[model samples]
Target: MSSLLDLHPMTRRSLLGGLAATGALVVLHPFAARAASNQAHLRLMETTDIHVNLMPYDYYADKPNDTLGLSRTASLIDGIRAEATNSMLIDNGDLLQGSPMGDYMAYKKGMKAGDLHPVMKAMNVLGYDCGTLGNHEFNYGLDFMFNTLAAAKHPIVCANLTKGQLASDPKNDELFFKPFVIIEKKIKDGAGHESPVKVGFIGFVPPQIMVWDAKNLEGKAQTRDIVEAARAWVPVMKEQGADIVIALSHSGIDAKGPSEKMENASLYLAGVEGIDAIFTGHQHLVFPGPKTWDGMQGVDAVKGTLMGKPAVMAGFWGSHMGLIDLLLEKDGKSWKIVDFTSEARPIYHRDEAKKIIADTKDKPEVVAAVQEEHEATLAYVRTPVGKTSAPLYSYFALVADDPSVQIVSNAQLWYIKDMLKETQYKDYPVLSAAAPFKAGGRGGADYYTDVPAGDIAIKNVSDLYLYPNTVQAVLITGAQVKNWLEMSAGMFNQIKPGSKDADLLNLDFPSYNYDVIDGVTYEIDLSEPAKYDKDGKEANPQANRIKNLSFNGKPIDPQQKFVVVTNNYRAGGGGKFPEIAGDKVIFVGPDTNRDVIVRYIISQGTINPSADGNWRFAALPGTTAVFQTGPKGRPFASKVIGAKIEDAGDGTEGFAKYRLIL
Candidate 1:
């Protein structure tokens, strides 16, 4: 383990001043009076949702990106450590599986007993004190996850993950990893006297992992509810002499009160006793910032607290580092927190011209740790698979039908139709549902998928299907299908009649949740409010946004049955879509959606991926709307099939605004 002084030379000066102020030298002189205070400052830093972004590069775009990478965040670690007397760096999970580098490691390189995963190698260089498990860590299966974690130099803990069946009592369950770890450190108080402080770290992963990665975890593992596990184990930590406890919640902050297996339970977990602070993630959002979680009940965004407990959530892909500064005073036999501050510090920021500017350079040691694997991942993603006749992009996916989503829907329909040919469902009408994974929201303007008319590579296919979910076919009636589409219509905000330049998209809704079902033509009525809210709950039972629904130029009958091809996540209820669940699933394919897409592209030597104008927004005279997209989407504005797009101007956060004529 590297000492704070060794990592940053300036920390020595800062430590001396901090120790003198704390009264650490009182023992050296018996006659000297004790210093004024016995308080010590401890800084806790975190990196969450790294997703194997060790280098400052985007594998899908095959270019350098200044906004991401742990190497860039590592550059700030030394400077941050220098500002504190005692500091501990930890990770808040989602470190494994997101980029092409993770795929190259899991599917190609393969981990062995002693082989260090590229992410672990890079993280080990920074000396993470501890880390928790994120839902993405289980994407590659348990064998690979455990093997990769075996090489981590620091302790990794998760209280909710269990092996086999869950026991009635959360404490009696067979835990897969240590529930918590108490790190003992020597600290100097105001009198320059060395004293011991026991800092406890407990971690919780979202229980939704069982549904998201059902193929990998069913029958082999189970998960307890996050708050239940925290409530059960936090007291044990205190009983074991843990003076201060920090919860590494790999969950998002939701204002909704506690429920069974809630995906976002950080707000509820913060209310648990004995937890001094919290490090939150799994939403890929930043706290103490104005983007998300602002104005939500129980969330103090300005103070970075949940239920009055200090908390921090770093943005995804190493975009920001979550920081928590604590002022601790020794209270007889135990230490208690007196005051605290929290922040999510970014590695880069946008300039006045909306150009990304990096705040720090990449750390040489962290980059060197994963250089070999980084090069191999580049080679792996660059391998050509097939060619496309037209360009594929998702810049206008939210406002119109898109080729990027069209290609995926076409591939899924092609594969599922052939798959059901020999089965009993062969005669059933087949439809495919697909969504744009990247639509330039919280991921930033450069995050949109843009592939030119040329050869398609593995990277492009991976960009189209961002998850490792397998293909699934669900059986449903026409009425249920309409309800499904109704749920997806929540992506847009309701526009009033005759309203000019109204905001089109519902920014709160995630792009991945906006499913576009193919093989059926329909129009989204913007004049009506969405029947469902973002959580799939019925917000307006009387609302109807879907209109002119037809299967083959005829109105779909309510009793008619159809098989919808989708990914395992949706079929298994990963997203809270109505009438879609495991019971409706008729077939679960063995291959991943990404693999199916690759195969589909290869089989069709050359393909033309163009939107067929199947779905469009209902025309409303005297009503116009506007939305923002990547600046690079200007040239392809005419390609959008449904609406008339006009240049509005430059938008905030490097996005270009466009007006939609309805």
Candidate 2:
């Protein structure tokens, strides 16, 4: 092969100049001159499901974690901007709530009229162009949400979230935020010629927010279907001269196709005509990745396309930055996408030894913006409440009765019993239902709750109960209670007899939905199929997974009424559990579940949060099943209640594998 050095001096100079003009080498100007005059490259950057992680710190763990933080992602953003000619940064929501900092602002410091939220401050410093609302934004109620959003420098749009009743025509609905915003910007083509471009940004929140935050929403707010809203607004944006339209869908990709008010409607929303690309979140999973959404119909996992339209879902807590690079060519007077690439760029990665390695440093401006609140949050979460006789962790929550959940259940049961003392339903037997929120799943191996045995702090309590949900009690018959357990049993997959190492837990079922009801005894029969699917829809009507169900040493009576202590989310039909809805709600406490946990801990002075042998799996002789949990669980494997667990090996995504002998 002939080298450029072998060419004549004039020819070499000409070739180098041509290569520089084609952006093959570093350009001296902001926009590199291109070989073609009509071509331009526009990069759309997305940070979704940030959940107020402004710094590289974990409030619950009270330690520095390199895997998460918007400040780290901000550094990556700075580099991404330099790589593209024209770029826009946007958030796909779930930004307002997650970390202790968000709780500190909403429940402790309280957001004043003009005060900027820490998350908003960090985002503003990074110059966010636009953003959207996630379901968690409604966790603290409308007043708190609006007060926090008021301080944002950028416009926040939500097409589906309505102030009151949704109108018959989606376009006429009284939207809580503007349906969409069009940004008119000057884009420099590859030839360095500036041209006007209109990019429309529309946002959507899951309609299920009405169910999840019923106490905060209820009759006060309503929502239109995501695809329904997109169908109504995308065309209007095109007609209004939008050169490109992007959907900021705070929803996940569900291959089940579109249904009425589906929670994960991003897949269907992408099918809406006139939508050029999409930014997805709410599932806390990345798109264009090797796993997740693989082999799903109408989904191009490797290409990051849903229904043939480009899309990206950045990992939650600022783990990754979703990027979509579009190569646009002038088609008549409007720009059309001729080529594109989608990616979920991470700020950190694991090394060969499974240690988290920081890929970028924290952006100073982003960190400085939230430094005050971050310190205050650390102080607030570190306040000692009481002491625990045993450690609390959620590593094996899915496969065994866990102490992490037991503590929450104990707190809730105590709180509910006291509250019902003066109520007419005091005579009803009380049971507490709690789930493991921080189990190893989409949140990754390090997401599990691990509180050491000793003094319990507010952060430890928060880790035990991840949500800011208020305690609520639902009155239902014993039959309905059994049905609820059956619904929760959907977390497990059916295994065949004599099968070796069959998958035990259902990956599609979220750990937070695997409610473990205290004050009752039950055995899950893995030999039987799950009666209900992850969505709480009946999958096998003949299946009876809940076996040997009993209460107070006797079989539960079908006609007997009981008071089930749970969070507002569950009582309001957040998980679609059978017979557990608004009508069944008997009591709604004023304090949050975390507050109750703190109070309970204080009252105990020294508590023993041990998991009682309340629930277990029915033994299937000669059968073996396997499950994955945080690698940290290995130390406590023998302490797990129920089945005999043995170390299997290393699992995917940094999770440790355990085999269950049945």
Best by TM-score: 1
Give the CA lDDT, 0 to 100, for residue 297 in model 1.
84
Report the error of model 1 at residue 422, Å.
Answer: 23
Number of clashes found in candidate 1:
12
User: Measured by C-alpha RMSD in angstroms, how accurate is candidate 2?
Assistant: 11.8
Which residue pairs come into collision in candidate 2? none
For each candidate, how many residue pairs have backbone atoms clashing (under 3 Å)?
Answer: 12, 0
Question: What does the lDDT read for residue 248 in candidate 1?
Answer: 97
Alpha-carbon error at 150 in model 2, in Å?
Answer: 1.7
Q: lDDT tens string, model 2, 1-662?
A: 11111111122322332234334543322223331589888889999988888898877767898878998888776567666788899999987777778778887788878888888888888898999999889878899899989988899999998888878899999888999999987888878899978899999998867655676898899988999999999999999999999999999988966699888899988899999999998866778775557778999988889889889988778888888888888888999887777878777665566566666677888888888998899998897757999999988888889999999999999887776775588788999999989987788989999989988787777678766566789999999999999999999899999999999988888888899999999999999999988778888999999998999999999999999999888997888998789789877554567767876887799889999979999989999999988899899999998869999999998988999998
Q: Alpha carbon lDDT of residue 13, candidate 2?
A: 25
TM-score of each: 0.68, 0.67
Residues 210-249, model 1: lDDT tens digits? 7667779989999999999999999999999998999999
What local distance difference test score does each model get? 0.84, 0.83
Runs in model 2 deviating more than 4 A are 1-35, 385-405, 410-455, 462-519, 522-553, 556-662
